[model samples]
Target: MGSQSARNIEVLNQNIAELNGDINVSFEFFPPTSEAMENTLWQSIDHLKKLKPKFVSVTYGANSGTRDRTHGVIKDIKERTGLIAAPHLTCIDASKDELKQIALDYWNSGIKHIVALRGDIPEGGDRPHMYAADLVELLKSQASFDVSVAAYPEVHPEAKTAQADLLALKAKMDAGADRAITQFFFDIESYLRFRDRCAAIGIDQEVVPGILPVSNYKTLVKFSKLCNVKVPNWMHKMYEGTDDDPTTRNLIGASIAMDMVKVLGEEGVKDFHFYTLNRSELSYAICHTLGIRP
Candidate 1:
């Protein structure tokens, strides 16, 4: 048994050596809604900043207050961390003129990267007048912004067909998007197939996989359903009966994430975007396993 365990360890070390610290990572954060949460967010940032991510992005919302908070967080990240901070811009509850103005403001403030998205329509609200592709064009016309748009490996919930979804992504890329950061996913095979389809359709832009380290299983499931992301039966069973033990859940989450990263890295994926959910331990551990260090 001891010899077998040593052999397994030797293989793992070989895989890490092959990865060769060539992986680049980025983190995503959401604006904190309360003082306590804000503190936690900053703590996580300080802890993970040592890893020196390529860029960090903050999610956006449709409301005015949330919009202000998003802007504040983006600027603060830039000022405090000296990291490239990207703010998410969505074409919902806003006009083209307004978005152009916002883009101009971001440019003037020295913010160069933007994550262009078509935000979720509010409950009972009117459908968006513009889409992500249009927003990408608008931003490009206003300034030379490094724009990143969203991609869905599992097919967007509203898309009528997988082909339509791929075309949507193509439109965004054609509109001068620098790259497409995918929605969080667990199914490694799904992402691999999606990449193949993109290449088949002549999409030359890079598509970075979004990795969500599950901190809370129940919360993940709820959000997954809303986003049309599937939680495989194995994952469901893995988390079953561990509701009260966060330590165990976190260990399991880290193991799954490390496994995913190992497989994806072997497939020549050099970039990973982590949806950190304002926590650092799980992501930090996973990065360490990938040979990323301070």
Candidate 2:
């Protein structure tokens, strides 16, 4: 048998080789809420554009009130930055005609990609009503643009079971979604298991893993709970009592993200979608760790 040291060196060399190639990456950003926020978003976009992402997505607000602003930002990004702008379209608060009109507008404006979603209901609101109950139906109704749907590796908060969630994902792909982007998860095992389950079900579209570099542990914990993503106890211990140490927290966050991506990369993931959360530094640092120099 080969020595363990030799095998380890071989694996390390393989990872280095994989990093040398062009790895497709995309970023997700929310539409700015104010003038200053708008400035920061644009600056982040400008800085990250040099990395040549496959495309960048701008998120829509829960109620669709930011529709105009989202459109404006997507249009500006396409016109000004030479980046493919994929605006998120949701079915939580829009009628069929309104959704179709928005799709038509995007098509007319030279935008071709859309991240179709069943957006979360506004806080403490009644059941959401719209043309599509979920993203699959929405994708089926709007056939003009290339559509992407959400996938949940750790299972959606509202989903009763992982099987049910996977079935929902299959329905989206069956409805002609072009790709699936997952919600952020810390565990690579969860992602790998989800991918295997998808393959078993014969849903074969690209499912890009969403990466979120933890900037604020407290905020991440809150969001993770809301979204049903399990925050491992080990993760908490890693950042335990680092609340006041911003510098140490960020360094630990970056290292954790790098380790996560490296493990996923080893599992044959070539594409990644980062939830930038409107900040560029942590994501930028993670990219650097992956040997992605812009």
Candidate 3:
């Protein structure tokens, strides 16, 4: 028994070492909705800061107050932690002038990177930036910001077809967007297929895979549905009996993320974007498993 355990540990160490630190990682954080959440958000930031991520982004919902919170958090991350903070800007319920001014403000505030998007319309809100391609064009006209647009491995929910979605991405790239961060996906083959399709169609840009650590099956299911992500049956089976066991749930979550990234690394993928929902333990475990150290 002791010999078998030792051999398993050695094999695990070998697999970890095979994934060198050639990877560039970034994180996405949502703006905190309340004071306590704000505290938790910053705590998670502090916990993960040592990883020296490529950049940290704050999500902006389609609302005025939430927009303000996004900007505030972006500046706070830059000032307090000295990390590269990218603010997500949406052309939702705002005029072209409003969006341009916001872009100017971000540029003036020493923000060089922006994630431009035509955000989801809020309940009863209008969508002024009808397409993310248009938002990318607008950002380029305003300033030479490093802009990233969102990509969907599974066709975007609103897309007419997969080919149409690829054309939209090409338009964004042509309009001077630098890269794309994908919506989180569980299936590795789905992303690889998307990559191949992008390459065949002449879309030249990095499509960083978005990784979501699933600490709670219920929350994961809800968000995945909102984003049009398919939850595989294997995942459902894995979380079957952990409804009340957070400790076990967290372990399973980390294990899933670890397996996903390891396979990605084998495929020569070196960039990762994590949708960290103001938590660090699962993300930390996965990153550490991939040989990413403080």
For 190-249, candidate 2 gives per-residue lDDT tens digits of 999999999999999999999988868999999898898988889999999999999988
Clash totals, every prediction? 0, 0, 0
**Which is the leading candidate under TM-score?**
1
Ranking by lDDT: 1, 3, 2
TM-score of every prediction relative to native: 0.95, 0.91, 0.93
lDDT of candidate 1 over 229-277, digit per residue (tens): 9899999999999999999999999999988988788778999999999
| Per-model lDDT | 0.92, 0.84, 0.88
Which tens-of-lDDT digit does each residue in 177-274 have in candidate 3? 99999999999999999989988988878989999999889988998888789999999999999999999999998888888887777676889999
Span of ten consecutive residues with least summed lDDT in model 2: 130-139
Task: Report how far residue 255 has shifted in candidate 1, in Å.
Answer: 0.5
Order the candidates by TM-score, highest first: 1, 3, 2
Candidate 1: lDDT of 154? 99
Among the numbered candidates, top lDDT falls to 1
Error (Å) of candidate 3 at residue 20 is 2.3
Q: Using alpha carbons, what is the TM-score of model 2?
A: 0.91
Superposed model 1: Cα runs more than 4 Å off = 1-13
